[model samples]
Target: SSSFFGDYPDVVAFILIVIVGIFVAMGSKASTNFNSMFTIVNMAVIVIVVGYGITFADFSLWTGTDAEGRSNFFPYGVNGMLAGAASCFFAYIGFDGLATAGEEAKS
Candidate 1:
């Protein structure tokens, strides 16, 4: 029942964008309403992952020395922690638009 379309990048790209455009064409309220349940489910998944993942984390990976002589939980030191924090900050930036959802929602 499956056919291959790997050769058609343009078709694939167009279809992907068209599908996203359909969702974007739906006003924010409609889209937000449709996604609310999914959002709760996503949050639950995040919580579960964070809770269970810590138990499996190896304390050994946190220990190690980089090119520098200093050693700590972060092998690369404070700069590495700062860089990691910065990257995580940007990764969640897409959610900034969601903040306005409160105002966008109809009473």
Candidate 2:
């Protein structure tokens, strides 16, 4: 059954897309129990990390070259800023997993 289960995740994601679409079309939003908790924690971590980074991180690190002799450290240049923004686009992709669950979770 491993072969069957191999494609199961995609099947499940497709099914969830359909269900969430229905809920959205009905003028309502689907809710999750841990969503608020997760959001608060996510924001708190970001604030703390950014604050700590600005306060104490080594500015010279980004100026240092990587194994490829390229400046790969974060916030390295204008290109780095844009690259960071592009990388961060995947952060919100975390939300896509919340829909691929069994109804037993709401308990």
Candidate 3:
């Protein structure tokens, strides 16, 4: 199951989300505005979580590499950088949700 989570993004991931949404919708979920609140809260949570992550991290860990340092986390040269950037591409989606949130509230 864990492998399925990352193996087939289209079939496994989309189907799981659709199944969950169906269940939630059947459960009499809140008005559309409720989703706006959730969206804003989710954005805030992402910001806070990312912000807080800085505290527990060792800045040196992303820097040096040796038997003692944790810096080798991205030893794969440009590939590591590419992977990190690609993974974070989705972080840019918050603004779109914000637009939907504003529209949902205005109505």
Better of 2 and 3 by TM-score: 3
**TM-score of candidate 3 on Cα atoms, chains taken together:** 0.38
What does the lDDT come to for candidate 2? 0.67
Clashes of 2: 0
lDDT, candidate 1, at 47: 97
lDDT of each: 0.75, 0.67, 0.70
Deviation in Å, model 1, residue 80 alpha carbon? 0.7
What tens digits encode model 1's per-residue C-alpha lDDT throughout 1-107? 65675544787779978865676678766666657867899999999999999999877756675567567565666888899999999999978777786557563
Extract clashing residue pairs from model 1: none
Q: Clashing residue pairs in candidate 3, if any?
A: none
**What is the model-wide C-alpha lDDT for candidate 3?**
0.70
Cα lDDT tens digits for candidate 3, 1-107: 35535544477777878865765465434434456677899999999999999889887657678775435667676878898898787877787987686566531
Alpha-carbon RMSD of each model? 7.0, 9.7, 8.9
Q: What TM-score fits each model? A: 0.47, 0.33, 0.38
Name the weakest run of 10 consecutive residues (lDDT summed) in model 2: 26-35
Going through the candidates in the order shown, the clash numbers are 0, 0, 0
Q: Which portions of model 3 miss their true places by more than 4 Å? A: 1-32, 67-73, 83-107
Give per-residue CA lDDT, model 2, range 1-107, as digits (tens): 35646643687789978876675455422434344556799999999999988988677786667877767475367887888888887886765675565433443
